[model samples]
Target: MSGVKRKHVTLSLNEKLAVLQRLDKGESLQQIAKELNVGVTTIKDWRKNRKDIESYTITIDGENALKHRKTLKRAKLELLDNALWMWFCQERRKGTPISGPILKEKAIVLHKKLKAESEFAASEGWIDRWKNRHGVRFVSISGEKLSADNEAAREFCVKFQEIFKENEMLPCQVYNIDETGLNFKMLPTKTLAASNESVTGTKLMKDRITVAPCSNADGTHKLPLFVIGKSKKPRAFKNLNPSSLPVYYRNQKSAWMDCNLFKSWFFDEFVPSVEKNLKEKKLPARAILLLDNAPSHPPEQELVKGDIKALFLPPNVTSLIQPMDQGAIEWLKRRYRRKYISSILEKSEQGFNIFEAMKSLTIKDAIYTIAASWDELKPDTLRKSWRKLWPEVMTETDQTEDQQNNDSQEIVKDLQTLDPNVLASEVEDWITECDKDCDSYEELDDDQILAAVIETDNKETANEDSDCEEDELPTRISHTDAKNAFDIALQYIEQNPTSTPMDILWIKKWRDTAAKSRISCAKQKSITDFFTK
Candidate 1:
């Protein structure tokens, strides 16, 4: 397909017949070939299509195969043992580097063990497809493991299913909660050789943006529970933004986001509210709070770990198995950050200050930013936050007519559509365009595992940038603040060699400080060399 220009060139029946007639009338082979502008052999093919070609037969097995004049092929078994084959292929794919032969052997063993039967299969193709097929991504982190034995969480998930199924509790009653870290440097995926060092390096990659996100199967979307904590003067409430939760929660003492505050909010505020909201309905078999194991919530986790009745999910299952992991938090953050980014894009550096800009937004404003981003993040958000992060392809069937109608009305109002006819046309146009785009997007396989690595270096780069952005970072020169600026720059440059130009934005602030006093030009030389280096 790649190299061949024309795999098969064919003529219409009439064209073929006419060509044959011309060739039969003693026309020169060269002249006819030149006239038709086809290869000389093509003329032979036209003739062979009728007169010269003879019927032939192939015998695959025996005399019966000859009598039927058909090639008999062996029938292949369906091999319901497929589940393990799929699982093995998926796990080995994440830089695990299982060779083709090993893959085939594993599939054979798995097929036999899982299905209680074994049959030969074409190893090369089947194993290749099994390992490479896409889909299961939400939970495939480096240290994360998959096992059928982790049925406890699934059992716990069933309580949610029962709550929804009993003809009483709809998805609205169920909620999944978990915390995540969203550091400035959430590393992008890359392909690298699998090494034991990198494998264990999962534990070492410390730079992160962690926050707790919650969700349920209900159509409703709400913000994640922000427990803002701080190392210094009351943790900043800025942590609870769509951008990050910790940024807003760090400074508050009795804040709803802090661990103690979160405990109070849960036992006092959240639980009481849930009870008050639905008076007639029974409380969820128990309030199934989905959560990640964070050091901050040791009391809560320890309570669950002890004989106390809270059911926590199994280890390493949050990515694929946790519903919140699928999208709710990511949606909130992405939408929140998109606005933050859009604000940056609009200002083009000088339009506004990023820190001061976000500092002014109220909680209500921050919540709205997340709400509006729902549509954009909906692809990742599933009905149950427990499904972890998997592909959810949106379709026309996904929306009820009433929902569609409501959305249509919303578009009209938001765009301030004065003309009904124009509005109608725009709705049709937008839906058509979106459906086409959705169709082309790749569908992920429901089976494969993704073991993504979180490289540490990427976080370092982000830290370098963050440190520069906030000019309060420690300086090098003690003699004078002027030299301090240059010394700081030199130290930063030394610490970071591959830093880009935009990263040096904070240098100007130091220069401003220098102009007010006798600046140390000596340190400036070192900083300049640092940049050059």
Candidate 2:
């Protein structure tokens, strides 16, 4: 039997992707090879060509590509295919209905523009194959309607309740995760003005950052915010370690969440954080993660681990049932806006021009504010957010709607105080404005999409040139300086009559930590000095 010739087995592209996902979850190459009945070198090769495989999966028709057992073939007219796909994606994102004829016409135009030497005709057969290759379909675009199915929402509620009963899941064991867009630099669109005076408005700042907030039903654990931005290394992050920041930062050409980024976050950040939280609480590692059916989110099968599972909410009912969408994201944005407005007010009082101060607001500033705002989100607020989705989990002690409204009203009043022109209505409008055009996935422009396709075609990583205008380097603080600052803080706390014992203890702890770091950085003694000592 051992001498018999072995049959050759070729894994499909989808199978390779699954293997990569398992590898990402820390499965060893040898173990995967054993499970798949394939050679270790085969697995190694797949892992080596992981990028190309993944790129092909994304750029081509996702569904049909799954059936492809061999290496993915490049399109005959690569440039035209790339350009047409980019146009299709952009148009679809804008809710434009694209017919088959329209797509064919676009492809023909792109082929001509690309100066392809091969004679080509865009026929019905070409359109059919193109659709199959790219996973295009003529289906009603439900997203364009922007309405929830109440019946579906009710049915899903019943199904969810059944699952809850069957699993006997604890509140702390169930989690909901969602992403929201934040126009960090946006200001109120409306303002009060004198009847006789004319009001002027400036163009709205469209710069956006994506923030994903996740927490359990009981609110015992809140994952560190997963933030996505456009720049890999923003000028604002100079001299600062991104990992040291409270939020987890990632970047791409578009700051939107994609399947790859989400997959990485799930395995790396979400799983580890939840495992730690469950362990701390003496709960079982088994848990559930609820996600929406956004294009950015990977399939549930890819997200499953031992005893933990990811489930999708009923489609088109996310707005009606998603726990995070209920109020958590809105609360975060409101707090962030309040912090942003307060900063502007502080800078104005310090004699800086108001518009200049706003303009100077950097990604670094926005990140810290986002972290602080997330921290300020009360556990009760988080628990209450689940009321719409999991009413049974809500405790009587959870914050009431009136209480939340009062909190929002207070922030609005603060904003009004900061700017006399700011109206309460305008503040409320501004708080929710960032979300108006927010889609879980980013809509890439033609150039960005084409560039990605081209890179994939060339099997190369992007080599972005450095910005010509270098930002000023941030001032560095030495360990000694940090230690001295801690000492000053301790002294202030010790002398303050109003300071509590806990405050003094905290200052001492910080001072000790800083002191230890400072001592660790001290120069080592020479052999002569050691002998003399």
Candidate 2 off by > 4 Å: 1-146, 158-173, 189-207, 279-288, 293-315, 356-360, 399-403, 419-422, 434-441, 445-451, 456-473, 495-502, 513-533
**lDDT per residue as tens, model 2, 405-448:** 66568767755665667777766766766567755576555555
Best lDDT goes to which candidate?
Answer: 2
Instruction: Provide the RMSD of all predictions against the true structure, rounded to 1 decimal.
Output: 30.0, 6.3
User: Could you tell me the C-alpha RMSD of candidate 1 in Å?
Assistant: 30.0
Q: Tell me the TM-score of each prediction against the true structure.
A: 0.33, 0.70
lDDT tens digits, residues 401-430, model 1? 233344445544432322223354554454
For TM-score, the strongest prediction is: 2
**Alpha carbon lDDT of residue 17, candidate 1?**
42
Candidate 1, residue 405: CA error in Å? 23
